[model samples]
Target: MNIKQYLDSTYLKTAFQTGISETENEIVVKNAIKEAIDEGFKLIMIRSEYVALAREMILQANSNLNVGTVIDFPEGKSSLETKVKEANEAIANGADDLDFVCNYEAFKNGDTELVKQEVLVATQIGLANNKTVKWIIEVAALSDKEIIQLSSLIKNIVISNFKEEDYASVFVKSSTGFYKTDDNSPNGVTIPAIIMMLENASPLPVKAAGGVKSYEEAIEMIRLGVKRIGTSSAKAIANGGNIPNQY
Candidate 1:
């Protein structure tokens, strides 16, 4: 399979997280952008602060690579207004895809209306801007039943409110790649989790993120019917090598 097309080459670490200075961290981001361009990956997923940089680089190279940025990253507890504002800023800065962390906590707390409202509004902003929108459900933070329920929740929202042609523009993504579990478990996409998402989120595409580190694992996800795979090890995976311990 042509794996590069399915890969969203990602780097979302901050200076503090990487134990490096801000300047050094930016250098890392720049290198990642360059690598994505040279490798012809589908998209480059970075923090919103670097959206402008990725846009300028892609423009300079005259490449077709799209720029993707996260909104309300890692934590999905932000208010609806805050999420919309963040998504708008990312779009203005030239982001082609907006990956929003869904309010999974609220869903778990039995606040379905809040979750539905955010999905509807955030998706409207993205579709109106002619951008692809993804909802990161953070499967690591949920149980099996929650995963299926939340995936179906997103699917129902899109199907009920959006046009048929617009369905492809919205996706129910698996994780944020930054959630930590207390017992150090796999806090990312697992086969079971992905299966649940694919079955319930259908008609809307699914993206498998987090803990997908190797070419083999990526292929498996794609074969299991995920349309996209987000990983920090895109370069190694593209080269058919296995690199572990990355988001």
Candidate 2:
């Protein structure tokens, strides 16, 4: 089934989050990049600070692995200008995919205009640069209705402003793999959430991120029609092993 091609090998932890020194955390990121190269995964998703390093490694290895970085990661409350600047910097640093954390907070607060503007501007920047773009909706923070609404919103915006051929390049990704919940519930993609996204964001593909651990689960997501599965345990999943307690 070549599940490796459907995986976006991800490592987005910061030094502070890992309670390690910057040098130590970088070592982790470097190993993840090298592992992605060796495993022939579809892409490597990392923090913005490591985009340049990832680019250098992938280029030196002559690997076809695409480099993806998050914009306003984990939090979607950043201003439109800030998101644009971050995305541009990632592109200049050689990121092939820009996974933007959409301003769902604003959308929830009845500020649809701001959300729409950011989606338009960010998608425009990415499409203009010939880069693939994905909007992270942080499904853990939203209800089913919100998921459908937001997914439809992104789909509608892309359909309205962009051409038909470009729709596939803009994805409605599920999570940032960093959201926290009150009951310590699953803070990433879930079956119900992914179903909602796929049902509502059709023609605009879906990328399931966060909480996808085992090869079986990844296969299930793919079976449910997600174009990509983002996970930290890419190697384990690719090899039919499981990494317990990994996000």
Candidate 3:
């Protein structure tokens, strides 16, 4: 319930065997993931196709790391129908959590309704199968005005679609690290920006990704109101960044 419960202090530390683009030769990445699992990094996020394999990998490591994957990924430009299918397939393949991108075009067109509907569909589908649906807002891609709009719309959607008894959780995440240019925090996911979102996002946990590469950075995010951090470095933070030759 406290802030630290949501911090992803060690992200890259979990990048041992990434299925995102096929780490056919980088055995170190795979080894790191296994080591991270054994080291007790319980929440692990992998690509859609890698979820089942990662799940099996987790088992082989003899660890209980929860598995999660992204939908629509970095762009959030996928059609609603496509996103729905991605969510279905990911969940069916054994994903415990889903980070979906925002429909920027929908928001730009002032289609708040459409945006909410997209989230609602995902929320509904994920709920039916007992999965968690977290919407990735890509804070860096939007303006201040757009961010506020997203907050208001997200707030409305949470109440309208997810009933308390339904047992589903909706979240607004910042960054997906899929941007072609940079792989760092927010691009604009700064402390102030995230703080603003988290303060207003009542009942919704904010997952901050990108630009979070250190314990101080991760802790800063928590202090700024982020409830969870979508980091891949689980072991580094737990080790004070002293892992021998850790990438």
CA-only RMSD, every prediction:
0.6, 0.7, 4.4
Encode model 1's per-residue lDDT on 20-136: one tens digit a residue: 999999999999999999999999999999999999999999999999999999899999999999999999999999999999999999999999999999999999999999999
- In model 1, where do residues sit more than 4 Å from their true spots? none
The residue ranges of model 2 lying beyond 4 angstroms of the native Cα positions read none
TM-score for each candidate, following the candidate numbering? 0.99, 0.98, 0.82
Task: Give Cα-based local distance difference scores for all models.
Answer: 0.96, 0.94, 0.68
State the lDDT of candidate 3 residue by residue for 114-204, as single tens digits: 8888878888888888887788777777777787678767867778767866423677777775554355433636676687677666667
Clash-forming residue pairs, model 1: none
Displacement of residue 172 (Cα, Å) in model 2 is: 0.4
TM-score of 1: 0.99
Task: Give me candidate 3's TM-score against the actual structure.
Answer: 0.82
lDDT of 2 by residue, 1-247 (tens): 8999999999999999999999999999999999999999999999999999999999899999999999998898888989999998999999999999999999888898999999999999999999999999999999899999999999999999999999989999999888889999999989999999999999999999998989999999999999999999999999998877686
